[model samples]
Target chain A: MNKQTIGFAGLSHLGIIYSAASAARGFSVVAFDPRTDLTADLAHGRFPVAEPGLDDLYREHSARLTYTSDASRLAHCQLVFVALDVTTNDSNQSDLGPLEKLLAEVTPQLAHGATLVIMSQLPPGYSRKLSAKLADNKLRDNQLFYQVETLVFGNAVDRAVHPERIIIGSDKVGADKVGSDKTGSDKPGEALPAHYAAYLKAFECPTVLMRYESAELCKIAINCFLVSSIATSNTLAEVCERIGADWREIVPALRLDQRIGTKAYLTPGLGIAGGNLERDLVTVQRLAEENGCDASVVTAWQRNSMYRKDWVLGRLFASGLLQNTEQTRIGVWGLAYKQDTHSTKNSPSLALLRALNAYSCQAYDPVAKIDAGQFPHVRVCDAAEEAAQDSDVLLVMTPWREFASAPLERLLPRMRGRKVIDPYGVLAEARCRQLGYQYERLGA
Target chain B: MLQHHRSPHSPLPRTVILGAGGFLSPVLQRNLQAHGATMMALGRSTIDLTKPGASAELAAHIQPDDAVVMAAGLTPDKGKDTATLMANLRMAEAVALALQHSRPAHFLYISSDAVYDARWSSLLNEESACEPSDLYALMHVAREKILGQACQQARIPFAIVRPCAIYGPGDTHNSYGPNRFLRSALNSRTIALFGAGQERRHHVFVDDVAELVRQCIGHASTGVINAVTGHAASFGEVAEMIAALAADNIMIDHLPQSAPVTHRHFDTRALALAFPSLQATELADGLRQSYAALQPASGLAALSSASPASQKPATKKEEAVCP
Candidate 1:
């Protein structure tokens, strides 16, 4: 199949990575953004996000990647990716406004038989609703595909450049629906048209084709399973600490077992903080309640996550680290929920900071910036060493690779006190003990 | 006689048992009886637990000072069908509603070790990932959440007990440890083993489970605990012990090894916290007692008369249910 022009609408995080990756795969890419300033910035190779290696890839393939605010440029492409990170509410509920707005702008300019692939994390059945809306507007069958996006913040370039797998959801029944209108065809050896096959063939990654609901559900199910593992692991880690058994040792043996492999997301930490797992749980709960399915299982997942999220605060209070020290200065390293992303949305570290009674607190992130007014007492430092300077206690909230690999000997000298709470156990316990630092870590 | 510790102001504590006719019910009943405590035992036949009014009716039946033990639910079977999952979930909802309505002093849920996906390790303690493979384990996990929420909302003390491979002489479900061996040895039959029989299992006698539950009832321990033997034994060790205790002519057969089944054989230190003085029967001695108990007049004659072919060696399917 011959490659066709692929358009990317709303050049946000998802759009830039996907468009760049597509362009790198030799597809002529037309990237669109409604904001004139953003498009102008992109044209001069100014990327909005601080993703590692993304800017270099953008620079290398900027020739094949066309950045524009014009909707007419999309008409030249046969396939379009409506890529935008859906905005989440305070309750972790997603607002589909950005997605709907982009769809309204792009659908009108789409050429006949042009496939619209939605590359965003959405609620279960959201894709089916989009498919129905497209069908109601008289779009051809299989013209709309809901493809799942698996991009992580720090590793966006690698995830996009080499994804684990590509999943495509289209309503096309067989090969006959590819390029031509064969509504009444009864032939056995017919092939889908090149135009339709080209949309699927454009992806160099292995594609999983399923129905709309299944594809939408696939994302939620995976997240739910992952969250369940996290919650269970956290629960066990707490038990392990109380029983004086190292959960770290237990987790490896569990991982080696084929039924519970190492990749089951069973790592114990300060619970789930990022938006992906939380959004999926809430989505499943909402949809289950709406459809009258037994949602109690998902609700448990949510409750467990909430309980585990407060684990750091619970540990700090229980350990007496925050007691008798009203004016204690606590240094926290890594503000993002997990390593490698600048996003602090529903971050567990920030939540822990909010619950701390200490009057003076310092925080540092590799890429994330804290709003001055949001955290009145938190002083945002430039680096990890600066954050630990003159601090009564050090709390390693996020397990960013830099902080994990930082020389503890150099950083520990700056702090006044010896208490270091590393939720991820970034520093070796034996080494920390040798340095005479009072160290506490999760699942130790 | 055991000394009783009572609160000065409160009245005598009462307790209610759901699924009172189960394998652990008799021991629980005897323990409660020994304490001279007021208690009520309800079986599924007495109340259709899946119905909407079941909880309300049960709450109305029990007094205010009473606690509720939700031990009633579908056990894992060969089919591991959807109906079993739905039934267990309904049972949980009913128990949660009852606890919510009655505002019990304590809500004790008897969960299973099967909730932990066996793939992780053999000696899973209280803290382990709940990776349930079949619907049975899934249902138990789901129930743990439903009841946990109800207890939280009602401000009642809640305790979840996840027992590992419970076995003893009274287990009519010949699938449990002692009964399976006794039945196989008495009939001079070969015991079909899954895997290399090297996968270890931490088996808790039924009486120990009863003691743990009684301790939780009396002490109001409000978290999850693993009710299991501290020691783990492989199937081969168990079979050899049982064979030696038999009529001396019984043959032990090894079946072709299949893929290992992942299960949580617990480390019961948390349980020991509540019942520090509780004694567990040694595996060999327990097998001997089980063999002796299976004598002709001990009422296991019917089981013994049933051929080994009828017994089917208690496959992994039977393992889902308690031994």
Candidate 2:
């Protein structure tokens, strides 16, 4: 099982993490992408996504990993996972064209009895139909499977290495049953296909076997629960602001409740900015509408998300600091949506900048680069303090940990005015107030 | 065995029963075992169909040559709400998914007579329209379609048995039918009826339904067959029959009707055509057997003139909505 080669199609974040982790697990990995430049960059240790320890893990396991643009190379591997990060349109609907094209290229090259696992986000019923379609092409039913990927953006490496449970959707009955070995393996007591089970055994986690549709829906169910938690926090945090209560103080009590455990996404933030959450919400809404399932709650989530996206901008307009906007140079800290990665899709910082088009904005982020043409009135600064220079107001939007340790005394001299709006409470509130700055934050 | 037993047919194939915890599954399991067939009964403890990985768990136990019988479902006694319906559908989904992967040689789903249009006044057959009046019936209708489609796609021979109100010893539902009538006679010595129990419904014994399942497996049958006795007796008549069979004098009382009086009659020609030699037990005899089987051992010695030797074991049936 350890000697079996694993193949990954598509060089998205999901593909990179799984490929690197597979290599780290001591199995030879073939990571393929049709894009030659992307494959070349990967081979040269240039990754397209950033995650803590991702580069180090890849560099250390480089000897076991193969980055290639050739589909034929996957034929040598016994198990392959289609780990394409589903691309979404502006409306958050998944565009499955690339995934279909990738499957078309890779399926023909797969070895006989090679397992094909889809680890991408998919609409329900898609996997079963895909299995049928593949069966039409003479592929055995057991050859195809669906696996739910639960990788988080900033923590991809850790999640890849340490999944709480591995959910593999297979048509083969008892494929996930413990101590069951009915996969027609000649070897005694092999539950799943010997190669597939061996690959999963490397993870040393509970493996769940289910139908493709259930597994596909399980991924959406996870995102929906997360969206629900975020919506709950944002709604309650708004109520706290009016009643003189601190959301941070209430979080501890909520965490103690068994129903709402420590991992609950209770912190209120600028609505759902990343495409993943919004895409799931939209998918649910569409599924509900199509099936006549009442999804009023899903609609409410979208409304809440839209209202929360403008939290920073709404606070800015409500404050009189923007009254003399022509004379004001605003300092904006952070551009990426909630940090750790460079993606800015539907970012609240960008939304704030777009709304403050009349003013000259000075922004500095540790990584995320802004498009100059999109925000012509904004100037990208070299350092956090440099953005504060000659600025009347400062807005700490993304809660990057480094921003918490910024020198307060140095910032006081750099800033022209004393208004500090830190929605995430990243900086010290007592120090900002003692420095004679008007510190405004959500939920008191 | 009715339905033209394939002469020189192979012995009963290995049978895997899903929803073995339900009232009828165990009975069917016993019948298959009695017929010298290989049986794997998957009760809730073995594999809960509503769980996350149930499909895989169920598929693992089933073999390519196995004949699978899916008799697991929630009755109206649980609830008639959408949630219950979804739970039942989830169970069916698990079976359908498992069948797709397992690709068994034969698949049979135990459906209900409730799937027929509640408004149908004429004799119902397999071709009758399925316009279920409630969620429980709708769940069965949906399940039949789900399992039917999966079997068709997998090329597995599929059969459906939509039995009428099934009543015998060890009945769990005790719905407003013969089961309830007999239990009331024994427990309280008072048989209560809704609006004089005027609504007539077909009630088949549990054993008969199990026999149909056995024959269906033996013949590798396809298509739908109603597991009915071709007997429609009013609730009042069934109560009276139980009262006659009981050792103690059972008083019959009529309560005000909650709904309008309705009666269901099934055309069992298909059942006859499928299993030509199989016979459904007469209602009077079934009530006598049920009354005797449900009585306590000490009470059996003092039983009424209804002799056990004079009666035969009854047919197995499904649930009929109460009026």
Candidate 3:
């Protein structure tokens, strides 16, 4: 069988990884980025996303993959993946301008039989509405499909290469037709095309072919479930400690049970970050309110997340770190929600820093520079040691690789105060104690 | 299994099983009983280890020569929640303090593989540098350190066991290790997998863990040891075995990998060296035992046999309210 040509519109982080993975899988991939500079840079092997193995994958599959600023390049491909990383605001509302612009530019170029799969994380029903709008503009009903993108920033290459499952939401007939053609031919009385099934099958993952709404809901549902678990875990972890029960021991057993498995988002941390879970929660609550569904569960999830997000600040307040200390210099090691990603959308570290800035705060991220333009009071230092210098309290927020392995002896001298609040527990307690630093870590 | 008998009138060797209501609590209780050891199963209801002075309070109850297994901490329930993670850490600190004052003969801590970060190549052993990804792991590392230091200062025996993916019979909370596969199989539900099932894992049966703890009680081994099966099994193989055992054509759906890739494989050589003759139950046999244990007649019989009137559900109003 001849290999299929896949085109990715909007060469953002998702596009870069997905297109590279497709090309790695021996498919002819054309990646179109609206930004000419980015496309040119990518052509020269410069990647926008700081993902492991992505640059290597791009270099290895450079011949099979093509980067272009030209929209017309997508016309030749059998499948088009609208793979843009949607931007989320502080309120967890997604600004779909990039996606909308990409869709508007690429919809005109989509061929008659071509399948357009929206492989971007969007609010539920957003894709269906977009598809309907495109259909109104004379596009066939089955031509467009909405598929959820499940790419973690640091491990985007792995996610793109091997997705857990692929969900496609479109009309059934269109999906069947596309799937049938791809799988040679449909059997007698074969299930009708699940409009999204064809697009999902194109990715070669376990396909969940459903209606547009369900596909959208499926994505949000997964995030909601994760957020819920995170909130519950965070809330109960405190209770476990307070009650003398070990949440860690309870969690393993919980994970062992099928109802809550090891994969369930149960690790207690700085709460939800990267905008995915937050966005889903917001979208779910919005949809629930609109449809008059009981959104209390989701609201509670959000509240718990917000509460847990401020947990560090709360600890600082409770620990008397901020008491009577007017010029308390707080050093924040990480800016992103988790490590290896530059995204600070709804980052808990930033939230804690904002609280600390009420006094005085110094922050340093290995990748992200704290924008002085946004927070004029905050100082963005060049190095972790520099950030710790003269700092009254050191908050290890993001579990960055560098922060985890940083030498304590080097950091200790730079720190003005002995109190170290390492939520990620990057520094070993034994070493911390040996150095005579008063340490605070979560779940220790 | 050798049945050792102790006179009922004679007091059994006092053993304090910390976190007695935990997943391993029942098994620990049973194994201790089999060993003719008196067990005090301390559940969270009786203790709040995260509170200030919890350790001092716990120490007041501890008697010299009593074996205290610190198996308590905040486990990952949903994902990483910072507050809960901190609380678990605090509990560990309390446990460490208690260990300091009481000076128990044996301090066995149950740690998780989460303590090791993704930088680990091949199977991580006991000597692996503690680079925890999540807060729970971080706290465990902290707790282990605090206990280790206390043990060193007090000159007491301390054994730290880090188990990876423990699963077996009598696992009620079914989300970790092989229980996820078994639970899905039992429910006739689809088991969704993330990424390729290629990430190596060493799943030890809970019974094995219980036995390992029992062996660690009087063993000369000190410091950290990976308490797991010395073999790595792919997620696909485990899922398939569970499906086959279930006799149901359950679909194993591979989903996109959203979380960080935690390629966990542990070397149990240190554990073996510590507890010689400790044999891990094979994954297949363990699954078979787990599958059989999940039977309604076998697993739920105790709960079911109790009169309905005897079992009273906690009232919504009576639920512990979080601050």
For B50-138, candidate 1 gives per-residue lDDT tens digits of: 87788887778666667678887656532369977887788788878888888977778999888887675544656677888778788
TM-score of chain B of 2: 0.89
Per-residue error (Å), model 2, residue A144: 1.1
Off by over 4 Å in 3: A173-204, A324-326, B1-323
Model 1: DockQ score = 0.02
DockQ of candidate 3 (2 decimals):
0.01
Across residues B145-216, which tens digit of lDDT does each residue of candidate 3 receive?
Answer: 878888888777777778787777655444535776776666646676777666668888888888877766
- lDDT over C-alpha atoms for residue A93 of model 2: 94
TM-score of each: 0.57, 0.56, 0.54
TM-score of chain B of each: 0.85, 0.89, 0.84
lDDT of 3: 0.72
Q: Tell me the tens digit of each residue's lDDT in model 2 across A153-192.
A: 7788999998787876766645344232233232321436
| Ranking of candidates on lDDT, top first | 2, 1, 3
Candidate number 3, chain A TM-score? 0.89
After superposing candidate 2 on the true structure, give the runs of residues whose Cα lies further than 4 Å from its correct spot. Answer: A174-191, B1-323
